[model samples]
Target: MNLDSFEQLAQRRKTVKVLAQDSLPTADCRAVVQRVIAAAGWAPFHKICSADHRVEEQFSGIEPWRFHAIDADACRNLRSHVVHREAAGKIPAMLASADAMIMATWLPNLPAGGLGTASDNESFEPTLGNVEHIAAASAAVQSLLLAATAAGFETYWSSGGVLRSRELFDLLNIPTQQRLLGAIFLFPGNVTKSDKVEIAESKLRAERRPASQWSRWVEVKQ
Candidate 1:
């Protein structure tokens, strides 16, 4: 398929569970690992990450009060609370086995109020800087997923720990100078349908949301 056709097909694919532990070849798995690093290296904010935590501190210019909004302590607490809620299953072990993880970072640069504005999710007004950072990070992430799919691997991102502890970052040797973006989890082969098959219908029925509510109406400016 051409790039455009592939992109279309990829978008329709859902995030399914992977259960094949030993079926994937070692060489192919290694190739996926290399591609993940390359994708994240080319991901947005690539130039901003460094091995130094001091760099991240320097880049984040928020004042004391505003800085507390994205507090590491609070994030940790929240993540700790949710970690055990996952159903007992082999999916976690399987993911840890066949896939690799990447913790991405962004250059810390934001006006004082920019940090606090995160609490105001009710407003529909555009915040240019936040929007741009989100867009850049999203594009980079989607590119990684699409690239993995093209390579015949399945991938998903889990922000759980990356959103909470600095462990993932520290483990990855991510510099303190870089602001953590998130983590990408990947594996080879599509997850067997049986793994997800049991709950798929229930999830679809219970979790469905109206697309119109999520989609924005576009208007062209002449």
Candidate 2:
């Protein structure tokens, strides 16, 4: 795509918190999800290790993270435990109306000196060693969002608290070594021109400073 087209796509991409009244077409939702995730996998990652290792093996390899897609039924079942009454009440309708919810997780890399058979959470350290992997996972999430926007789908990246709970990890059978980054909600609705202003206003979207404000070209002086 040309520069203008690319710019348009970037500008067109917006976080869709509130979905439209209609639900996504079930028949095509899976295909759309697959395409977006495939695009996410294409993100440039620093692959320091292989992912095809056994559970017993020490996971020292730094590979791209994994994404899990949860359907409406499962989302509803999980949302039942939401503490906030208003949020809980809104979840079913929101989840039912969306195409799917995608969970992004950071895989833990086992240290060389094996920590025995202890759980991942107990053994793993969120230090500089795994920082690159976390950055790669964030890139993957961005790619997925861009791909969904290009495919005429609205997307929302939410932590939602529920996804981070221990209950969710157990329910999803996610390993303790893996850390959930956040959840992405995919909707079928396209934000119209008229609705764009309203949505932007509702969120009080922050103004971003120009590159001049954040960028630097400097020489070190001690």
Candidate 3:
């Protein structure tokens, strides 16, 4: 995408807090959720097999954190676990009630004996078969995100929770061979900076690495 297009999408996509007080209409929410999913369905992705992979059904009254468990498990498998901070059954709603939602999960048919590094270090390299599959899955999710933004919705991708939990993979009915890629949440809310809530300064700021750190990895030829 062009810089102008990327900036517009980035500005529109904000990570809104899934406040307990805020609520979304069930029926309307479901419709867009389906659309976001359908868009991903239309995107091209690797055809990986899942011996036991299954996503939870759409059930009313399910909370947001429950969905977080699934995300949690996925992250754990990838050696990037997020600390659990809430009870079960509280996550689905956060997803269902969102303005829109997007997800990147391993579909059935992934090649057997997926790849991984000795440790989490140097694990991002695509040489490992599974890692390469995940990279492809992420690309597909990016398509879904951009499509949602183009359609006028805010979006954010989260691989923090489920990238590593094997049990979660089992619960989601995902086959032992398949892996969960990522999840994205989208909202119809406005993205202006003025509407943001102030955070306590006591919170530790996240450190960002400069792009130069990875410049050597990029192939540049004169």
Give the number of the best model, judged by TM-score: 2
Shift in Å, residue 58, candidate 2: 18
Residue-level lDDT tens digits of model 2 in 123-160: 45566646777788899898889898898877778774
lDDT of each: 0.43, 0.65, 0.43
Where does candidate 3 have its weakest 10-residue lDDT segment? 59-68
Top-lDDT candidate index: 2
lDDT of 3 by residue, 29-142 (tens): 555555655565444444342332334343221111112222322322222212243332323434433454333454323333553331321133333544545555666677
Question: After best superposition, candidate 3 residue 13: deviation in angstroms?
Answer: 3.0
- Report RMSD (Å) for each prediction in the order shown: 9.5, 5.2, 9.7
**How do all the candidates rank in terms of TM-score, highest first?**
2, 1, 3
TM-score of each: 0.52, 0.73, 0.50
- Which stretches in model 1 have alpha-carbon errors above 4 Å? 1-4, 19-28, 36-95, 110-127, 190-222
Q: In terms of lDDT, which candidate is stronger, 1 or 2?
A: 2
Q: Could you tell which candidate, 2 or 3, scores higher by lDDT? A: 2
- CA lDDT, candidate 2, residue 156: 79
